[model samples]
Target chain A: MTSSSLIKSFERVKEDNRAALLTYTVGGDPDKKTSLNIFKSIAESGADIIECGLGHGANIGDGGAIQDSTYRALSGGIKTDDIFEIIEDFKKDYETDVIIMTYQNKIMAYGEEDFIKKCISSKVSGIICVDWPWPLNLDFAKKCKENSIVFIQLLCPTTNEDRLKNILNDAHEVVYYISMLSTTGQKLKVSSDEIKKRFNLIKKISPDKKCIIGFGITADTINDFKDTDACVVGSALCREITRSINEELNPATNVGNMVSDLKQKLSS
Target chain B: MKLEKGIPLIDQHDENGYWGGKFGGNQIAESLNYPIEELTREFEKLRNDETFIAERDYYFKNFVGAPTPFIKLENLTKHLGGAQIYCKLVSKATGGAHKAYNAVVHSLICKRLGKTYIGGDTGAGYAGKMLSMAAAKFNLKCKIFMGTKDVERQSINVFSMRSYGAEVVPVNSGSQTLVDAVSECMRWWTSENEEAHMCVGSTVGPTIFVKICAWSTAQISREMRKQVMDEFGEVPKDMKLINCVGGGSSAAGFWNEWIDYDNIELIGVEAGGPEGSSKHAAPLTNESPIGVLHGATQYVIQDDQGEIEETESISAGLDYPGVSPLHCFLKETGRARYTSASDEEALEAFQLVSKNEGFVSPSLEPSHAFAEAIKIAPKLSKDTIIVVDSCGDSAKDSKIIAERLGYKI
Candidate 1:
């Protein structure tokens, strides 16, 4: 699918007075079969875009919840190649916009050209390399465009105008603006006004691309995206899945409820 | 060849006809080649520039304590019962090491290249301290990357660096040590070219870096001449200069001024690791061949297929697998003799110096140099004067030695 179509889908969701549910699941988190089922479940439960996290051994940015998930994935013997296999399986059974959020080493290890080709073959819609900067990585940006893969640039609260302009100049598809300084699971104390101001500044620089705010965003924080293109609730949904696992509840049901509640709150 | 005034070390061809021949080209990444080349050319133009020279001289004299005193190791020499030993007290330099000299020069070079941010990788933490001081004095942004292991080990140095306003980025890749820190810094420098310049921590690269370090070493040699004249009334006829070689900075610093002096025998002591093992010895004296690395062609430890081999030594400062190209050339031509001291011998010497002289010389770098002095002193007469470049103090390494030797501090 083209990047334009994916952007259209998000716009349609906004038009329908519903939040774009961007569900995040660790690729091969438990196993390939379990993760594929989770991806299928996410697609069926009205997730507009599925973000599959490729876990690494040294996860500098991951918090406790994701760190445990990564360890479980590794203990279940999930290698990076298993991620592509899981994506291929999900693509065979489901049709939805897919984005791979991962560290740069996995891509470097896979060899850039081969990785792009595999993403293209799997029909992956976009990619967000967490540690890679947009300005310093123009070569990867060029290759991503050549392979018809949308490259998503991340802007944070600390991003200055010069860096923001540089990011926007090379950014494609969408831009994911981190709402705060802390990691995925950490509590964010910054107010909605602050987030909105940061988002507006980024929007001014990247007017052509969709801007989604992520990190510590929950059902209560849904209104934070009143000025944003979309709100991404990742850690909240993942936390619910963790709670369900501890309570012996079905994770699929818990995830479904979490996203549905956040969606309702966003719409209200 | 006539030496020019304020020219630092005189650039003269040796009788053996080697002029940075095999050891001189810093074989860095092709991406860095242009910037380094540009910097080198620009530094050549500015080296003799009055403003640059004035700034250098001022910083050296005031900030770094130029012409650091040369102290004779009379007590230690008498105990050893052979050659009289002296030390070029570089610990007197600001930031307490020889690194200030190289760091100031590189900082100036970066400023001339229009770089506002300076970064480096350090094992001894000397470069980090020096860069921090330079950054504070010059109003440039400075960031230093260190191995996580070194961070845990050198907490004092880390705190010292932060005290001077340098951001220390701890790198936790591949053994989480100096080598990995250097690789990560290279990656960062490549990505952040617009704002950052890598002020390399070693003196093993281009002629300019060597020349700057040589100037620092020349200070040692110049002071030694004065000390000898003050003590004995003339320049000593027979003198042996011994220094440790990691990436070969301190050794090169002392050797640069005396390369043309045929009467002075230059000796370099490398970490032998274990006697028979490659794990403890650095690459140049153990398992290395002719190859280019980090912008210079020199003796490099590489695998059979020519990939760089990772090296380890008890001393973090001596953990690199490549030696200065000039040192490699000197080794090949036999202008300087290279010897290896085992981790055990270095440790013994470390303890001996602390116990006898009340001087705690840290790491295996200084101890290794002293170990070599001990070995060679027995062969020389009592009148022979040997100068050892005491690179760093042992305060940073006391805990490690205490733990390894099972002794309570």
Candidate 2:
């Protein structure tokens, strides 16, 4: 997907008065084939944006669930470049926005400009650096902007006013608003009004940027962020994917059904 | 990228990196509720505070035994008939290891910050003991997380920490080792208030802790430099500083002074288990690719699939999957070189040093350093001086040694 298409995704969801569903899955949990099937299922399951995790087991943003999946993927021999392959396959079949969520080392090691170029070529819509703190990554973000790749920024519940102002004023296509300080896979509840209040703050700065809530969100807690532009359900999806693989169930069918259930809940 | 002066107990990001690198930067950034800038600013203020400095100085001089003895190992040097050897007896310091310095400094920081609790991780137990003692002195509650296996193996140290008024919690996470203990500590740090600081065990966490530990540990090099010059009339030209690299706290501390010097050789020895494998901890020697573990970019011993492998060693302290990023930078920049010794070799060094110099190191980590120093000593001329970091006394290792020797502990 191009940069415009990614923005169009949020616009399209807004038109229906239904929030976008941004689902996350790794490149190769058990192996590449299962990952492809999982991506295929996700693409057809009405996801508006796809957040694919890069393979690094030492993901600090995660708890046991996502960490275990990343380890399984890496232990399954998934490489950094393989994530692009999965994204490319998804783009071929679905119009959903594709974003690569990763730590900075993968890009730093690959050279920042080169990484941007590769993402562009892969039809990746945007990227979110989990560790890109405010103001430190402006140059990299600028480089990404120039290349037509959306440099997605993330803000947390605890992000202070000065820091949020600095980040949101020049925010690009999308901003990931973490629902809580806890890592992925924890059980937490966020009220719709509370999320709306946080969203209103970002809305004040850059009315154009897309906002989504992630971390500890699921079907039960979807209402909290369902009014926003998007809601990301990552570790929960990965957990179900792992269960399917471990139980000898069809990963493609299992993932498709799981995502479809969430999408249905969102639209209803 | 702007480079701050190379002082972090006082500064945060330098040209090298913040929170260390791409891998480590985000963990703290994403996890902590407190803004990193505020933490850095307050730390910078405390860096030059005279009250804190005086508190540290008074403890070192009066209570903890500052200026730990630097002695010429005459018998060991005579036995080798090669390089003259010296031992900086850090084992004689408070808590009986080089880790006490950082514990005291961090405890003082905790006090100044008005924190009620101080938490930290331990493997071999020296660092936990130091933190517990410091917390007791500072009137703050202390909690330590150690591996379940370590809690069993180093039971005496567990008892020692408990005796010092700390609550030692056994971590039953991945591998149940030092790396897991660190992970558990980070978990605890997140749940606690921002003011509640954890005594990071080594120079391997976020940039602030790395700088603080290195600065705190630098006391070894500082005291050693002054004493060596006083006794020998000039700095030894071919001086070699050897330290066992677990998380490389001692190496960072020992090498911080001489790192910029061209002639001095700084050697960090890693734990090489049965297969010369990193599956248990010899990253620099095993040449594990650079990855993030606990927020620092260094040689992490992970498999191709990116699963960090558990490290094995006779010394619990030396059995970590990675070392300090500063040590990694040193190895990459040629400021320091890394070597390794297998468990058998380290065990032999442990026995040899105890017999020859009447020194039994509490932790197995320094034995690797001793093993490396023994190999290097014989090839060097008599004028060359090799300084072995005797990091801790082996009283804690008595049970393990007895068990190893087929005696019931």
Candidate 3:
């Protein structure tokens, strides 16, 4: 496999003996200019990778916070092209690997082959489609691999052994293990030890592939999975953005500080 | 006549999960994989099981009153004076709509799968009422997620569900309607899947859901096929089957048996909103692009940027932006045709049907189909025959009808 920035960043984090911190934020949220600034702050605040959400109409996998972000971004007229532009501008200044998180329709509606071409042009490192699970993602994963982009696979606690093995076999650099059975933003109901147990089982199957736990991961809970390869924090940051907007504060600075605090919590 | 197992309209596509190699697929998040797989395995086995078939047939005959009357509409046919019109009064079924066919079967499957909690999402509440009734029969805990707006519009159904011991939860989210309700129900099922089985109301959602709904309601076509053969010597060569297409459960059932019959032409009618208005729920007729919504890929009404657009219609049940993936497949393969009826036309049809035929409380959803039948009945040859599935009673639509007709009720 060709060396990509996503793998290199994971290796760097692994050498530091700490889990990588991947921050997720919707692109063009609040507004286009403020969102770009927010991305920069997240990267500077020690987020190893940035998962920029592409605004969509319906995000069934997301909770209220991320859904609110998507609605705000969409009502502000943020399109797929606008998100690509945001990523292009963000890449010019930061070395932080960026991945686009979107629903399948956004890619399918844009034409699959043309979407990949745009991803390469926009300097996107990888992609995670919330609704595209397992073998359905096989063909798209192949297209993404041909273009040197990491297509992240999502596995839930309910995934059976056969399906899990199939997914991991086709998985590329990163696989997202949903920490629970709820949507993003729900409180972490499962104990950290249980999460570790699940992670250990996956490791026994594919020790080489890097897996990240997402959904319900917040600053209060970030330290729980410190022993894992990486952890993704999404809805908590989106909630912070909402609170910042409501409090009449600079959202970029507030969200940036929150990410910094999350990094601090993980490291401590 | 003894009720028996109904045939599936198409072969099971286990490879990619897409129906007709294009429309339907299990385009859902991973959190739902286990529950869907469990339901799929059990349902696939039970659908063909002889004991299960007999149990469903027993309920159809003794409980919900299946084999609803298929009668010639003499007055309206004489008034139109062109084609022979027949009405399949599915509205006479228990719970007052064709929704009972799918709902009762789903509840039974829920029992067979060993789940004690049954849940679903409803737009107009017919689905909620039917499921609630079935759940009461099966002695399962039932929860129906309805949009806040739908709760207000479909209060009668809400009352019926509650009377049957089902809790109705109102969701106040984006576009409080059928689409949001389905999303919320899926979210609920994700966390509660271990003990609960979600009963989807229509032939929408993941591949398993589409198959189950279509298979359950295929009983409608089974009865229709027998009635046609027994009534007339054989299937009429110029026969046309018409039904409303909101997620298309009733229409799926009404059209399943005739899919392979070259002699029969199927017509699906969708809500066209107010005349001359841009807002409507006619996704298939309006030329929507293929997009995934509520778990399945189908023709969805979306903006140029691929955002799901709000749909408007006189009837709450028909106010959905997406159509069934099966309907999309049927349309693409040219085995079926689709059209639309405006709010004005549907309202007119409601009045005419109620006044002339004395079929009071014909639902606004099927009124769209009635509008089309009324329109073309005069233009076809006298030998031509059209069967309209009067799928639901409009007791829940009294408020909308009152408001539209400018009456206090």
Model 3 per-residue lDDT at A50: 94
Q: Which ten residues in a row have the lowest lDDT in candidate 1 chain B?
A: B9-18
TM agreement with the true structure for every prediction: 0.59, 0.87, 0.96
Which regions in candidate 1 have their CA more than 4 angstroms from the true location?
A: A1-268, B1-20, B205-218, B274-277, B359-363
DockQ of 1: 0.03
Best by TM-score: 3
Cα lDDT computed for each candidate against the true fold? 0.71, 0.78, 0.88
Ranking by TM-score: 3, 2, 1
Chain B alone vs. reference chain B, TM-score for every model? 0.89, 0.93, 0.96
- State which candidate, 1 or 2, has the greater lDDT: 2
RMSD (Å) of each candidate, 1 decimal: 9.7, 3.8, 2.9
Q: Best candidate, DockQ-wise?
A: 3
Per-residue C-alpha lDDT of model 2 across residues B1-409, encoded as one tens digit per residue: 2212454322334453542233233235454636344555566788688887887788866667889989888888898889998888888898789888998888887777777889999989988988998889888899999999999988888998999999999986667888888877776675454557777898887776777788788888888889888989987788999998989898878776676566889898988875555355778776788766776667888665445677788889888998877776666656678888888787778887887877545357788888898888999999898998888888888888777767885
Residue by residue across A55-98, what tens digits does model 3's lDDT show? Answer: 57666787888889988899888988999999999988888999
Residue-level lDDT tens digits of model 1 in B190-304:
4455567777787654445555555545555555566667877966788888888988877777766567677888888887876567665465566465654444455666543
Tell me which of candidates 1 and 3 scores higher on TM-score.
Answer: 3
